[model samples]
Target chain A: MPVASLREVQKRFWDSLAGAAGIVAPELADAVVSGTTLGSRARLGIYADAYASRLIDVLREDFPRVAALLGDHRFEHLAREYLARHPSEHPSVRHLGHGMAPFLERRSDVPRFVAELASLEWARVEVFDAPDATPLAMDHLRAIDARDWPHLHFVPVSALRLVRASWPVHELWAGADPARLAPATTVIRVWRDASGAAYHAPLDARAAEVLRLLIAGAPFVIACEAFTDRTPLEAAQAITALLARWIEDGIIARIG
Target chain B: MSLLPHLGHGIGLRPPHYPRVADGTARVDWFEVIAENFMIPGGRPLRVLEQARTLAPVVLHGVSMNLGGSDPLNERHLGELERLIGRFEPAWVSEHLCWGAYGRYYAHDLLPLPYTDEALAHVADRIRHVQERLGRRILIENVSSYLTFTHSTMPEWTFLAGVAEAADCGILLDVNNVYVSAMNHGFSPHAYLAGLPPDRIGQIHLAGHSDAGTHLVDTHDHPVPSPVWDLYADAVRRFGPIATLVEWDDRIPAFEELVAEAERARAIEAEVLGARRQLA
Candidate 1:
């Protein structure tokens, strides 16, 4: 028999290890040298096991809340399913869970909140290592000229992310039981603080709308328009309060 | 005799030890960070890495280069790595000698390669490309494998040495991997070591492995076992005090315990080299 080319061997080896159940082809198995204790199949099985376990571990780390809710056995199952459909494309394992939340969203078998919870978890992961920026200080805001306040566009930090879910996923992330939860639209803002700690908070409908505007680089006046349902004084007060909170949370990066 | 500096003992800068590293408490001669882990834009990992570099020299150790793969090199991965090299100014950079990706898909695990002439030339060319792109020679570390290709025309060490010589790069001799692969494949660890040109050994890695009954797996969770320690002593005797690191990726202990592992490597290296000097 002719020796397999390097490409042929890699393809066969990868095919054998790619699936959840490693099915080593006859040609591939024939290529491997069987040891005294472990057979060719068993030897290939180690890579197969590692292929699943290592990726599953990465998913487990990225979505701890989802894992906690699913439990180890079910989480492993879900992770395997996720991996089969979406083998990693990026060189880094950090991006392995990029499709996980959406994958969960597409599955009808999983609880509705589970996908949202995963989205929240993945946002935290994204914000955890996002680009660093100097957050806008409250003193800086206070130092701004009153005339420039309306024209000022608040630049959100690079680490800030807004995850919207149909379910109150923040509660689920906070350890609320999934079974006891009710369907409610939730907007969670995830960001990294100055101390490099990742944190998330649920935003109210009005606040979420304004934050969305701010994140989109809208002028302060345009963002405050999100509170049009309230009186002008009330809207002004709310926008002031929100700005203070954002500045404190280190979500606002700069004033452009 | 090695081209790289003998930077004393070091440990992998894992997440669990970030606080200590950031607070300027975790002290070691050097740190070996997973290059992929720090390839991100910014966060605590990069911040802590900055702190780590301030405290000790750091080497960028990557797992995803896929130097032995058949696919075209991922330029984005290389660009990110080059960015990291420019920013952190690591003491040196290293990657595995195995392939991890095929085409668009990545295994994320260091998959073994067949030690044939074709593979040797292919990998050597890729390593040369990588070295030329990075503008610096890299240290390629051998991976622990559970199986070997029957079509392999040469021993693993020879293939490794051939790649190093052809690519004109250095070798990051992983002693634990040598032991694990030897146990799994039924080869002499000493012979594997002796096969390599000692001058090409730029660094050494010491880690723990788990016995899976059928074979030993390079788990890196447990403390460096006695046999691996013995192997480290042998490595010290051969390579003579190359920059060594203790790798504990999973089931990480406290920072102090991890430091203790590095300290142990220091002790073993001293013992082996001291005894060698006595013989002379």
Candidate 2:
């Protein structure tokens, strides 16, 4: 038999592992030396099994809420499908589930909230190691002149993320009974505290609108318009309360 | 014989012991971290790594260089590794001799290569390129394998030695992997050690393996097994007092327990070298 080139051998070996049943090509199988206890096919199967098991473990860690809701068997099945469709492109396994939420969104077999829940979980994973920044203190906000308050813009910390979903995913994420929940649009702010701990909280309608404006780089006066339902004096009070909360939460990185 | 420093025994820094590392209580000779894990922009892992470096000398051991793969080298991964080297200033950097990625897809496992002339030349060239990019020599560790290719022209040890010599790099001799692959491939572990150029051995890795009825799996979940320890004694006799690390990736135990394992390696090395001197 003619010797296969290095490239050809790699392609065949990869195909066998990536295939549905780990069926090694005859040429590739012939290339392998069968041991006394394990044949060439079985030896190759070890790699196949490890490839799936290792990746599934990574997915389980990244989306524990989704895995818990779906149960182990169903989660494993969905994860295998996800892997087949979208193999890891990143060198680090940390980025393995980058496409998972979108993939679940396209599927109808899972619950309606599963996709949103996945998005929320992935956001936490990203926020866990996104980047490090010195959070802007409340003193920075106080230093701004009253006349310039309307034009002041705030920059969010690098670890901050705002997730908007049609379903109340935060409730599910918090271990709320999925069966007792209804479809409700929610905006959740996820960020890492100064001590490197991750946290998330659902925003009320007014606070959500204001945070959205602030995250979009809107000036303080424009973002305060989210309180249009209140009087001018009341809106000023609401904006002050929200700014204090955001500063305490360590979500704002800079105010200028 | 190695140009690398003879740092004492150490353990791989894992997340379960991050608090100990942060609080300045975890004590060991050094720490070996996965390079890709710390290649990110920021977060707790990087912060922990910084703390670990301050506590003890840290070395960067990578798993995804894919030096033997058919695809083009990943420049972005190299760039990140280079930046990490600049920031952390690890004692030395190392990666596996096997490949893990192909054509943009990563298997995330140390996939073995056939020991043919073609593979030898390809991997040697890739290692040279990597050394040029990082501006330093790297130690390539041998991975455990379940099978071997019939079209190969050489043994695993010869291929490893050839690559290290041709690329002018060092070897991160993994004793447990040698035993595991030797058991799986029906080769003699002693011959595997004897074939290597001793001067090229810059460091050593000791880990546990699972006894699958047919073959052993390099799981690194258990304590360093008796046989692997025995092999480590032999490695000490051959390589002298080289830097060694205990690896426990899965089912990681408490920090003290891991450090105790490193201490055990220290004891064994002392025992072996002491006997050698007495004989002399």
Candidate 3:
């Protein structure tokens, strides 16, 4: 081949190698494996091994408690297999292997708790990078007549995240005492305050439904109806409760 | 007399240091920020940088300029970088003497360029073009490399000095990278320092490196080692109190610890400046 063509081929080969090891075209893997001077599949194994190892390292850094919960051997095995399937999508190492939790949840053999743990980690990252907005001030609420509370539309802070899981994701993320792990499920609301500290409020099913309704842009009056099944006319009381928590957390952006 | 007179020895700020900087404890005369980190839409990185900007003088050090590459410079990244520089109002903007992209593919690491007349004229022309585009002269820093090309007819130091002189740009002389590359390439760090024109040096860098027994990697994982500090002192003596920075990119310590490292550079600078003044 001409020098230019040869350089092009080399570039293509290396590009294929990078793509194969990332969350990209799998067809590139065969080319990467064959393009090298290894002469055997074992040499190409190094790429696969390094790819899986680097991603597993990223996962272990991002989700240390998840790895601890799954134990070393199981976490490494699962991470290796996960990278082989999903690869990485972003160029930044901060973004690599971020979807490991969802990938695990999709696997039939994986435990549901693993998915919950992943959601918890993802929520933490989301809260950290979420856009900044002005917190809803109590002065606005005081300005409104109490009669308008039912029709009020509450906008939560950018960092506010509502996560409902069959497993106790919050408990796992908090690294709570092992004895408390007996809980089968938990609904959690995670948010970062204006000061950039993260906190999670564990809620019951009724509160979770109310939060979901609110998250879906429902009016306070309509969201309160979901919780009315557990308590009578408690919509007013529940709205008051949630709004107070939101205010304390510096989470509410606006209410009108 | 300095373009960035308020800037002093400080680590290049990364994310792990965000909390410390946000808390307002990482003390130094200034902080160096990777230009790309703040290029994104509003997020914690920009938030922390904006907050830190209030606390200290910040200088923009970029990696993706690709000034020495065959490929055309990415004006999009430069435009975003310019927007960030405006927001932060950084004291100085600096990039590497090497390239990070080739033929449209961006390499995350700074790759060395062959030091020859052709490469020198190519890079110098690009530097002039870049200076014209940004409407300001940017500083160019020497890069750490693991390999050298046989096609090069001139030493990298001479090539770098040529580029600085030809393009009328300043030099952000990274002393630790010089030490690292000298040890790897079997050259004298002192010669590399001696090769540079003192007037062109606008800034200095002191950073830690990993000694892998065979080669010194610019890992920036620990305190500035004794030898690198000695080179930094030598650089200060030669360059005469340019903006000195301590860059720690990995295994970052507490805010106080990074400040302590910067303080070490301060003490060294004081000693070197004292010696230079006495000699004068």
- The top-ranked prediction according to DockQ is 1
Identify the runs in model 3 with alpha carbons over 4 angstroms from their true place.
A1-58, A71-93, A106-109, A176-186, A228-232, B1-6, B14-26, B39-48, B64-79, B99-108, B113-135, B150-154, B162-168, B254-257
Which 10-residue span in candidate 2 chain B carries the lowest summed lDDT? B97-106
Sort candidate 1 into its docking category. high
TM-score of each: 0.98, 0.99, 0.80
Per-residue lDDT for B25-104 in model 1, tens only?
A: 98899999999998888988888998999999999999999999999899899999999999999999999999989867
CA lDDT, every prediction?
Answer: 0.91, 0.92, 0.74
- The best candidate by lDDT is 2
Tens-digit lDDT string for candidate 2 (A87-179): 889899999999999999999887779999999999999898988988888898778778888898887788988888989999999898889
Q: What tens-digit string does per-residue lDDT give for candidate 1 at A57-160? A: 99998999999999999999999999999999999889999999999999999987898899999999999989989888889978988778788999999998
Q: Report the C-alpha displacement of residue B45, candidate 1, in angstroms.
A: 0.7
**Candidate 2: where are CA atoms >4 Å away?**
none
Question: What's the TM-score of candidate 2 when only chain A is evaluated?
Answer: 0.97
Candidate 3 local accuracy as lDDT?
0.74
**What digit string (tens of lDDT, one per residue) describes model 3 on residues A149-240?**
67888877778788778877777777875456764668888887776666677888777777777777788888778765556456677767
The candidate, 2 or 3, that scores higher on DockQ is 2
Across residues B96-181, which tens digit of lDDT does each residue of candidate 2 receive? 99978866899999999999989999999999999999999999999999989998899999999999999999999999999999
Clashes of 3: 1
For model 3 chain A, where is the 10-residue window of minimal lDDT? A1-10
